[model samples]
Target: MSTPLEANQVEAIQGYDAEKRYKYLVKEVVANREIWILTDEHGCVMLNTDYEDCVPVWPNKEFAESWATGEWEDCKAESISLNKWHSRWTHGLEDDELAVVIFPNQDEDGLVVYPDELDFELKQQARKQNQR
Candidate 1:
């Protein structure tokens, strides 16, 4: 209920500080629509919609390792982009069912979330799922 900078604030700040101080950005998911970037105050930046840039990767030793190390570029160019990957993985899952799944990783906790097609194929099955 106080003063709130509109969308132009971000562009204004950017223009004002193009080569000056860089503000630290804290990105958080909120209300399924608004994106809040916090630093020292509220409404420093606001986005009305969601944004994601994720790349699909298989949850296996050979595949996950290759993706982490950038070895599968030649084979799966489309799936390597973060936008494509995130879209492919959570395509058919319900909103609540789209929770992140972490599998065991040789280096650490699992970091790969793959598409359902690769999932079924890797499981030695032949089922296809579609996005809604």
Candidate 2:
């Protein structure tokens, strides 16, 4: 487990570069047993196992907005950090589920991905459904 940061220390991170802040957030989520982050229908950050069960919990509006739009290239978001992006929305999670962070594509509307071994399969299914 990582050392818990005091409120002031956490506040200090606000001044950190996006890369540093992003890393710290991921570290916290992993240490807390891998809570996953997802986006709800309205593009707010959420937590839980399935997309349907997710509820908005994270607090960073700017980060959430960028992620909702997939404008992550400038954010230097790698797969791992991107998965942990939920931490950018808030400092804590509502539950512990596998430390994953899921993002919805602009085309996916109400759905999000879990990004595991089945990620490709899931994406294919989503595409097929969209083709309907």
Candidate 3:
């Protein structure tokens, strides 16, 4: 069954173009520190942030918001343009250590990497990972 939208959420999202959609970043926090990568209902990982794409697009606001509420209640969602996503992803990131911290992803081990590294290659890796 499709989850019903909460009144406040519905109100907050009112006036949005139902026909228009944009990409959103959804995050899940673990242990109060580590941020885990979250996938959308389609199983695509939400790695785009305000720093990366110029026009990241989603199918619709409801599809984007589904991760923040409803069945995906544990995730947090943020709408982002493609440009913003890339911009924030690399902004203020210097050391490899800071890179990871600014942008984190799921690690091979259950324990997530905090203050993790975001080398240029990581972005490519994430995009490829999302395809899977």
Best by TM-score: 2
Residues 34-77, candidate 1, lDDT per residue (tens digit)?
11111112311111213322233222223233333333233421
Per-residue lDDT of 27-129 in model 3, one digit per residue for the tens? 1111111122334556424333333312112223443454355555665444334344346533533332231222221211111122223223344445555
TM-score pick, better of 2 and 3: 2
Candidate 1, superposed: residue stretches over 4 Å from native: 1-63, 66-78, 95-98, 102-104, 111-132
In the range 23-86, model 2's lDDT, one tens digit per residue, is 4443444444233333444433444554444432112323333444443333321122323433
lDDT of each: 0.27, 0.36, 0.33
In order, what is each prediction's RMSD in angstroms?
19.3, 15.4, 15.4
Candidate topping lDDT: 2
Candidate 3 residue 31 Cα shift, in angstroms, is 32
Candidate 2 residues lying further than 4 Å off, grouped into runs, are 1-4, 36-132
Better of 1 and 2 by lDDT: 2
Output the better candidate (1/2) by TM-score: 2
lDDT of 2 at 44: 33
Worst 10 residues of 1 by lDDT: 22-31
Better of 1 and 3 by lDDT: 3
